[model samples]
Target: MVGRGELTDAAWERIGPLLPGVDGRGRSWRDRRKAINGVSWGSRTGAPWRDLSERYGPWQTLCERFARREADRTWARLLEHVQVRDDFVGAGEWRVSVDSTINRAH
Candidate 1:
């Protein structure tokens, strides 16, 4: 499920130790992870939150959670954590494979 969200195994492994347990509120991290996964899938698929599948719990819940997470910069922290752990790899390895073109009048 995490892979389907475009999370690499190495990145997941690096971030796993830093994640708050979903059970932090007695709901279980597994459940929260699924909820987060729903957000990822929903975003990737451009599906409405109300259309999220039951396997991820209520779509409303995931949507609310995603909003809270965004407000709190949870995703940014996770990326920063991963970046810190991977700092030894250097910037040359962090290349983005993308193509873009711009028109300019000379």
Candidate 2:
């Protein structure tokens, strides 16, 4: 497997299927994926949106999509659904750890 900073085509393939579908405007799923990925990539790389590559999507569009999703609770619902499915499917075991101690200062 390649290290970070490298774009694996599989990553794109995995995310491609999960993006929202286009409507009568005729936008492609690829475009939506690129926009979403672009914002994540920029944030991961610590780069300005203007520096984002076209292969992703327009920086403005990416930022806007992310913002809209955040405001609309789409991401929240997605996370909840993923957690529920993971629990049911046993994809990964969930472990909870709690620490109980009294601080000396208290």
Candidate 3:
């Protein structure tokens, strides 16, 4: 059951492999999807880390996971991947247009 601010299965499939230790040794960490969902919840709601819901497990763990990914530039790569997917689907052109009119100071 995906939570309110969680990625769907398809999305998780794309992102999960990019995270650490999916294929590594030692005891596996908690569910990556749930940890991501907790991070998403915290980001979307601006809630205090300590206030994370128990359903997502320890807040500290989630925060640390998020921090690790951020430090390693994983977040940027994930965004780029999603953007590429969007481009492939013909979602829209990636462009920006700006219009400006300036008046001379009197």
- Which pairs clash (backbone N, Cα, C closer than 3 Å) in model 1? 22-29, 23-28, 23-29
User: What is the Cα-based TM-score of model 1?
Assistant: 0.62
Candidate 2 RMSD to the real structure: 5.4
RMSD of 3: 4.9
lDDT of 1: 0.69
> Which 10 residues in a row give candidate 3 its minimum summed lDDT?
21-30
As for lDDT, the candidate ahead, 1 or 3, is 3
After superposition, the stretches of candidate 1 with alpha carbons farther than 4 Å from their true spots are 1-3, 6-13, 20-30, 90-92, 97-106
C-alpha TM-score for every candidate:
0.62, 0.56, 0.75
Candidate 3 local lDDT, 57-78, one digit each (tens)? 9888888778877988888998
Per-candidate alpha-carbon RMSD to the true structure = 4.4, 5.4, 4.9
Q: What is the C-alpha local distance difference test score of each model?
A: 0.69, 0.65, 0.82
What would the C-alpha RMSD of candidate 1 be, to one decimal place?
4.4
Question: Which is the better candidate, 1 or 2, if ranked by TM-score?
Answer: 1
lDDT of 1 by residue, 7-41 (tens): 56665566666666553443554555566668888
